[model samples]
Target chain A: MTDEKDFLSGYDPGDFPAFAVTADVVLLTMRAGRLCVLLIERGGPPFKGMWAFPGGFVKLDENLDQAASRELQEETGISGIDLTQFASYGDPDRDPRMRVVTVSYLAVVPDLPSPQASTDAAKARFWPVDDVEGTLAFDHDRILGDALSHLRTVVEYSPLAASFCEREFTVADLRRVYESIWGVDLDPSNFQRKVLGIDDFLVPTDRQSSSSAGGGRPARLYRLGKVSELRPPILPPD
Target chain B: MTDEKDFLSGYDPGDFPAFAVTADVVLLTMRAGRLCVLLIERGGPPFKGMWAFPGGFVKLDENLDQAASRELQEETGISGIDLTQFASYGDPDRDPRMRVVTVSYLAVVPDLPSPQASTDAAKARFWPVDDVEGTLAFDHDRILGDALSHLRTVVEYSPLAASFCEREFTVADLRRVYESIWGVDLDPSNFQRKVLGIDDFLVPTDRQSSSSAGGGRPARLYRLGKVSELRPPILPPD
Candidate 1:
């Protein structure tokens, strides 16, 4: 054992346990009115042929955020979307090979093009979140559950639900983002009233969305508001 | 580079990242009407003599939770308290010694005895949360801030604030937990009403706390109720 004099100078890093750190991104979006997540199939061993959240090991030179971005672009062909560092999973047996800890990231994207798989992925595509089964390659089933719960909780107080909508959208569009994610039918009038009651929750735009066919009235468009926080946050029903 | 045939056969885990994983526990407890966090002074580099959250490297045989428990006991000698995994920090430049990613855990312990520094620490003690300047080594200050914010938010809905108190405590005790953490004053009557209004928040105990001196009154003692969720969460004052 080294004394204070030999502590820093003769310290051997190998004396401590070695662990690999990876990043997993849970990219959620709405397609055909159903919530979906981006997933990839591994081209190589360990969990080859099984579906997993798009991810890879972090590089020595890169930060966790940069690694998440690079992996997102490599696996899903999506970039510039806001990614939040959600949580970390470090269960020793999570990885079959050895000790591996993964930092999980979450993002809600608008309508996106089909994803293309590269690097270690055999294929990449958007799969409906409701259709997800326990066959996920790792602890991803648990990770996805955590991400969904966070989404449910935060969407109430934040403009997070709007991230799944177009730049200029209607109250109906925003409501659908909540309805689809929570998998519950929100009373249209009450949700509209509650959202409007929240100060600066949304800003009314001059233009209105075109109403199709039967000639109902075109709904007014609203943009994301400047208010950062919801004081009395809108919460999901008990 | 190995071909598909040789990929599985020749895969070397060391070919990728070689990061050392660590568990940092942010143990918070109220001492003398103030919120305090347990910290340790390092005896060796890379940041010797500076204060840091009680933490150390994960051992090969121990899981992350076990590492956190061991590190906490080694640094502060406080055990049997529940520690929750909150987040992970993996910024490349976080640790100057080597590539290390740490999972941060949040623990709320009741009034504890003075801590004894063991293992790698020179000294261990609880420092008031408000007194913590950015003088913390590594990104511990940021991690501490995140834990405090999470605490302030969750204590309203979750039974988190109670974790800082002994069993069968006064409403004043619970209110002090909020006041200390949020650093705000709660109107006594309104606070009591709101807390009691939350169904099953507390169950009255037959015992009453002894009145300190004069004739104010002995506060009622209550135990935690079975209700798991707080429907309408209590919000901090604006």
Candidate 2:
């Protein structure tokens, strides 16, 4: 074994079959009070013409996070968003042609205009998360499920829920993000007390949105606070 | 861009460099009231002669979980244990020799004898997790930290805490598992009530431990119950 290890130290790339590693971005944003995911229409085979997460093969010089961000920029003309590497999918059959291991990332951004398709995709669009009724290309269906579970679990303990909102948002706006993702309606009074009571979860801002939705008293706006940790985390439904 | 996608589809494996993917096991067990991790002394180069997590290169046909479990069984001669895939580490430089991505898993088992070394490892032994004081080989230090955090968090909301015990265990025994992992002292009265009050968390075994450690009354033995989900999970210390 010692000799084998020593011999392998100088192992060359030609020794084993090369595998392509890529990063797929599940860029999520809130649109019309519903959670939306950014997806692309493939322009080439194997799964050409099918909807998939925006991504591409990783460059040899970049790390996983960098690759994910780069893919987002290259494929969607989107940039400067904070992307988190969530998990890696490596089922042998996940890819058809050869072995491809995809490191999936979750990117949260403020609501924005439709993305301009670039690179290998024919079209880029944000699909309401609730509307993912059709089968996704590749093993993306499972990847999306894992991302949603991670988001649901982390939202309770981390201040990540605010990432989907604009710089200034009302308490109702923030509540909708949680309700939309968890697929449950929360008691408005309890939800309000919980968010505001958490001393550092939100920072009050002296801003207000124009009375747009309907005739009601203008609501105060708040921005995401600097704190990253949430105390006594708000657990999701069982 | 469409043409570029077409070019990529025709791209051969020979075009890109091949990289190896591996799985490492953070196999954990409770022994003599202390949390212990399975470690193997490397018999190969790179970090030859140092202790590290039990792992190996993944087989082409096996899934990530299968590879991890196979590695555990090969290294420790243990099988049929429940192992959970937690995270994947893929820093290009994580392994100095090549670009290696390692999927890590965490497993809990009842107390077992010192593992016999097998396969690539020269020696297999269980070390008290607290005693792993220095840096480990191949980015294992970071992997260990992530696994421990997952364990601490999962124990609260899942029935996994009892995986460290035999089919029947006393309340004191279960409390010891919590203390070993959290490194905290808990009030026996409160802990007992909390565990018992959570319906389906545990069930009476119609049995009793041969003796009690604190001395006074005989301790009742119980087995894990059917409930898979935990409500109002036991939160760790602030």
Candidate 3:
């Protein structure tokens, strides 16, 4: 082994180029029977006025997750939400001003309230996943595409789809979450059979949803189950 | 919307601190019915002579995946293997030299030859996963734990376990891969039933392994099947 002194002789911390690190989040939710993503209109350079995921540079004092949460709160007024670190983007030319590497995070909210943009963003709004226009700021289009794919994959094996629903929801509500995200129509009975067959997928409550003025039968309400992963995973229709 | 010039006036590229990015690979393989991880002895400062994953700084020219593959080849003399980017670690104090954020990759090989250390690594060898001593350099211990958990989870849902076996293997060979990684003994009949039950889990070939001198029947050889994911995923025994 080389001695510390010998190693130090050849090593210089300043020799290598340093990179700027940023945390960007792709926040998604289900609203009005469709999947929506929170996008901010860039108020600053590089891609001014263009839509982008709310994000910012990582501070020296905070860790990556903390940076993600802080940026989400500072820019969009959304706080205390769970974020999953999905992927890191570091193309040499990703940022024009400098060499920047962005760590991307994914957040699934249960119908979050509207967001008010501040701190470098001119506007913030939830755009239906299909309604997202042209290109997003930076390489965010790629990042958002990856995040959506990650969500679709995890929803099959894990009970993550429940995160998009209210505390207590009917089986149809859960089915819609799948349908909207997968962009496919599913048979009601087949969906219900597959959902209920998975053990620990739902905890049924005695109370049922109130019948609408049309006078149809009420659907039973259920809470998210104990297990994080679903057995006999609810695969999307082919 | 803010004008590009006005946004540029307020933003300075040098205002935020820069970070050094690194790519570390956790290479795992099954040998002699034991789960082993590839480790290299560090030749330089902070943790000189300590065992660590083969890694180094990410170059300015390459993408994250390319950097990971390059680093693995440079330090350990292993190349052309598939790597999965599992997680990134960026605790402010992870590296003592400077603020370094490491993107970790996991590679599962099928009984490869021994590795020869080069560049900054003094020695390279496979260490049984359970036999890793003390603390590894930097936050590698936590990184390894996360990688192991990722492996365990994916083994249930994906055909990832097959990556640890030879191209042509028997049902017992595949089962041993699980038992070794999960560190549990499984009932042979039950294991065979579950594995065969999963559609597209294995493709049977027209050949079988030669019978042992102990006079046992030759087991049929099979290759990995068409599907990437398993339906009704093989759950680990309780």
Candidate 4:
């Protein structure tokens, strides 16, 4: 007790190196049959003019999730999207300005309107996940890869793929969501059978597609399921 | 670009409130047919004497995962445990000393030797998950709840439940691990059917438990299979 009291009496936070925390967001949405990630063109030094996830320093008052939402809203003028804190990155040399540890958030939504850039971003847009040309600023390239991998896994077990569809969609539409994100051509009948086999995975509506795009039969429409997770997940092809 | 340049020119990490980062670990293991978590007694003021997860400030040179492992070893004298970064905690007033953000890791293993406390921890021991008496120091109570929920879910889809058992175990031993952690009574025959249905979930071994405590036929022992995930997750009873 005497040794502990003595140590506590002289304990100082200043003894440790200063750490700055930031929240970065990897916002994903389906656009034109492709998975796209929201990126910003940095307008200042420290990877200026390079692309990176929409993010900024976490404020003193707000929590990490709030900081991530605020950064997304401030930089891209897009808000009201549900965000999940997926992972945190804290490599000592990740940021040049200081020892910055970033908590990364992930959000996947249906297609969104074009982003309006502000703050330290020269421009904001959703780039196809596979089409990003060069390295992202900082360790964002790694963060993006992690977020994508996480997204791929979750969609298999959760109703997250429905998040990319409209309120009511046909089996083909849902299959396309899996195909675009997983980057695999799944047999239409097989995909439908797998998804339908999962109890409560889909709620069939008493309607069909207005236009018979195939000129044979209008696909049956369905809504999101009552349950959140998919038992017997629809596994992608090898 | 001009506005961004001006903002960057005056950007100083020092301007924001000083922040500290730490790593905490939730060490879980099966003991006496119960799930237990390793906790340490704080030796200093501000919740002194309260039991909390083994943790300390993260060093400048180490990454979050490395920091978590180091803290677990430094405080509890336990090493070689596999740790997964489950979540991060960064409420503004979580720590009275300063604005501290903590990355929390979770580890489950076969029973370990009794812990020996050091560093700022006055004592260390494994407490049954159901028997944690008082509120844990800081936001650890919430962190513990989250870690438990995550453990329960992962065990259903992944081969993590086997982590609590010996290298080779019987179907009954494996069932006990899930039943203990999930707090449920599972029918033995039904449980065996569910597990065996999963492809590559359990590999049959040529040995059986020598002592058939039940004066009956000895149960066959098996090891973990090659597949990491279970395609059709064994959902807990509603």
lDDT by residue for model 2 (B1-238), tens: 4322332345765565366777788988898888888886666678887678877767678777887877777667788988788877777787777787777889998887444544444466888877884656777878888888889988888889999998899898899899988999888899998899888998997778887556777789999998786776776676
**How many Å off is the CA of A8 in candidate 2?**
7.8
lDDT of 4: 0.80
TM-score to true structure, per model: 0.91, 0.91, 0.89, 0.88
Candidate 3 structure quality by residue, lDDT tens digits, B1-238: 3232132224787766788888889999998988888887676677887778877777788889998998777666678888889888888998777788888999998887545534454467888888884568778889989999999988987888998988999998899999987889989889888888888889889999998679888999999998887877788877
A1-238 per-residue lDDT for model 3 (tens digits):
3232132224677765688888888989988988888887765677887788877778888899998998887766678877999999898888788788888999988886545534445467888878774578778888888999999999988888888998999998999999988999989999998888888889899999998678988999999898777776787766
lDDT of 4 by residue, A1-238 (tens): 2222222224775665578888888988888899888887776778887788877777788899898887777766678877899899998888777788889999887786544434444577889988883578888889989898888888877888888888898888888899998888999988888888888888999998986556767889999888777876667776
Instruction: Assign candidate 2 its CAPRI class.
Output: acceptable
Q: List the residue pairs that clash in candidate 3.
A: none
Model 2: clashing residue pairs? Answer: A18-B18
Fraction of native contacts (fnat) of each candidate: 0.45, 0.31, 0.44, 0.42
Stretches > 4 Å off in candidate 2:
A1-14, A114-122, B1-10, B114-122
In the range B147-191, model 1's lDDT, one tens digit per residue, is 988888778778878888888888888898889988899988888
Pull out the clashing pairs in model 1: none
What value does the lDDT take at residue B19 in candidate 3? Answer: 89
Per residue, candidate 4 scores C-alpha lDDT tens digits across B1-238 of 3322222224865665567888888989999899999887676777887778877777788889898887777666678878889899999988777788989999888887544534444467889988884578888899999999899888877888888888899999999998997889999999999998889989998888886555877889999898787867777876
DockQ of model 2 vs. true complex: 0.36
